[model samples]
Target: MSQRVRGVISRAKGAPVELTEIVVPDPGPGEAVVAIQACGVCHTDLHYREGGINDDYPFLLGHEAAGVVEQVGPGVTEVAPGDFVVLNWRAVCGQCRACRRGRPWYCFATHNAVQKMTLTDGTELSPALGIGAFAEKTLVAAGQCTKVDPAARPAAVGLLGCGVMAGIGAAVNTGGVTRGDSVAVIGCGGVGDGAIAGAALVGATTIIAVDTSAEKLAIAKRFGATHTVNAAATDVVTEIQKLTGGFGADVVIEAVGRPETYKQAFYARDLAGTVVLVGVPTPDMTIELPLLDVFGRGGALKSSWYGDCLPTRDFPLLTDLYLQGRLDLDAFVTEEIRLDQVEEAFEKMHGGTVLRSVVVF
Candidate 1:
């Protein structure tokens, strides 16, 4: 049998998201149905509505979610009904070349639900990032459900499914920040703050935050930044280097995803230091760095897709840290809103007022 639930939908580019009834089918093979408890409003959702991601109209927005497995299809045993899970986009296929090479985090063949959710008239809805949960319930690939500790609040832990996970993993996994290392994160939004928190969690002694907004910089400090640089008023590269003993940071994370910020991250790192680009940039945007500098840098320039995270590996670990109070996941939740309030939340996001306006079901 199918289930009908209220969900947020963007029927056209630049249109306001509407709370409408969506049809979710029973889980097919290798799929599961999740009863969503909370879903975080992310920039990606806004991008979808703006047609920034693609022309896939009628998008079912919202991917950062935590929920309970309501049902699992045949041949699915990874998670059963009643399991608390953080939904992920990458459901790694073990047979992919990247997985076979023993790096499942780079798995090129990830899975999503074989079936599609639809409107009441049976118009298929394109799920954002293949795992839409801006609704009371959602359907996803069984492997996309990473079971985490249920003790963590849904609004807090659900963030691990998207931007937070990207930021945290970009620092720890891609940037490889370590104890006593100096780290700098640009763009003190949710993702940047997540990177700051990750750097702190891993024992990085010096964590510098760079942002234009004083309010966001203050939030970054609360998330574990040792120093804050107001990017609008200060030269980001100079400030970062000044904070790092004039050698620049050991690892600089470019969370803003613009050419300018990327350039800042490129120049704001110490010699042989890592530069991790975790932010999503638009297609037309381009960066031109001196070829000599590219060779002279002598360190990795890596892009973190979903923080280069393996859901099974990272989600549970993050949850454990949250439950133990070692990580401040709750600090990411600025406010909670209902499903219908998502459009309003998007405006707040545009105004740079809220870190995250989560939808609690």
Candidate 2:
């Protein structure tokens, strides 16, 4: 029997999402159904509504989430019913080329639930990031459920499902930030702040945060940024360099995903320093830099996919950190609202007054 549950769905391009009934089938082989406790309203969901991600309309929007497993199908052993878990988009297929190469983080064959959730009329829904979670219940591949300590707050740890993981992984996993390394994050939003927190977790000595908003910069400081650079008031690259003893930071993370911020990140790193871009850029956006500068800089430039994370590997560890008081995951939750307030949350997202507005079931 299919479970009829309320979920948030975007029926058309630029249309406001509707909280309507969806038919969620019991998990098929290797699948699991989750009872969502909390789901975050991420910018990516808004992008999907604007037709930025694709023309896949009537999209089931929401990805970052944490919940309890309600059911599991045959062959599903990763998580059992009643287990608390964080949902992840990348359910790595071990047979994929990337997985075979021992770098499952780059897995080319990630997966979702084989059975589709549908509108009451039977129209299939495309889940955001293949893990649509803005619902009372969501179905996903069993591998998509990463078991974590249940002691952590759902609204806080659910952030690991997306932006937070992206930001933290960009620094620790991709940028290889370490003790005594100087780091600069060129955006002060959720992801950039995650990078700052990750840098602090790893003991980065000089962490500089750059942004146009003083409010965001101040928040970044709480997340472990040792210095702040107000891009609106000064040259971002110069400010980062000034904070790093006239030598640019050892690592620069571009979280804004804009050409200007990308350039700023490029120029704000020390020679041979790594540049990690965790921000999602539009296809129309492009960057142009001097060829000699590119050659002379002589450092790695890499893009972070979900912070290059291995969910099973990272989520549990990070949750432990949060529980231990070593990581301040609670700071990310700006406000908590009901399922119906997602549109209002999106509006607040534009206002930049909140880091995250989470949906609590």
Candidate 3:
């Protein structure tokens, strides 16, 4: 049976998200219905509202979520009703070449529910990142739901579903940050802070945070940044180099996703160091560098898709870390608001005052 629930939707490009009734159909084959408990307001949600992601209007926004399984369709064995799971956007197809090579993180054939959720008039709503959350309940592919310990707090650990995962993975998986490595993260947002925390988790001795906002930098320190560079008042590259003994950081994670910051990240790495770009970029943005510098730098430049995360492997482990109190996931939750406050959360997001404003049901 189809279920009716209240969800946040972006009806048109640049339209403010609206809280309205959405019809979520019962799970089809290989799918599941989740009763969303908490969903974080991510920049991607705002990007959908601004029409920056794509022209998929009437978008069911919100993907960073944690929920309990309410129903499962035929052939679904990954999760059962009452299981607590973190909703992942990537549902890897084992047949894909990436998966065949034992690297499902690079899975090229990720998937979502085959059936569509719709409005009262039957207009199909495109779920954000293929997991339309920000609702009382959501429908998604069974593979998109990664079960974790129910003991973990929903509002905090749910962030692992998206931005936070991207950040931490950028440092640990993509950049290969190791003990004693000097790491610098550009942006100081939720994602950047996650990178800082990841670097700290991996024993990086010098973690430098660069951002325009002093407030964000202060928060970054709490997240494990050993040093901070206020980009607004100083030259980013110069400051980063100075902090790294006039060389540069061993790994520089670019979480801002702009060409300028990308350049800073490129030049802010030590010789043969790695640069990881976890930030989402718009379609029209481009980066240009001297071909010689590309050859001269002689290091890896990588883009992190969902932090190159293997949800099934990473989610549970990260949750355990959180539960153990070693990982401060709770610090990421700046505030918890009702679903109706998502719009206000967006405004706060733009102002860069909070790390994450989670919607708690």
- State the displacement of the C-alpha of residue 44, model 3, in Å, after optimal TM-score superposition: 0.3
User: Candidate 2: which pairs clash?
Assistant: none
lDDT of 1 by residue, 39-130 (tens): 99999999999999999789999999999999999999999999999999999999989999999999999989999999999999999999
Give the TM-scores of the predictions, in the order they appear: 0.99, 0.99, 0.99
Candidate 1: stretches off by over 4 Å: none
Q: How many backbone clashes does candidate 3 have?
A: 0
lDDT of 2 at 58: 86
Q: Tens digits of per-residue lDDT for model 2 on 176-199?
A: 999999999998899999999999
- The true-versus-predicted C-alpha distance at residue 101 of model 3, in Å, is 0.6
Candidate 3 is scored at a TM of: 0.99
For model 1, the local distance difference test gives 0.94
Worst lDDT window (10 residues) for model 2?
236-245
Clashes of 1: 0
Each candidate structure's count of clashing pairs: 0, 0, 0
**Cα-based lDDT for every prediction:** 0.94, 0.95, 0.95
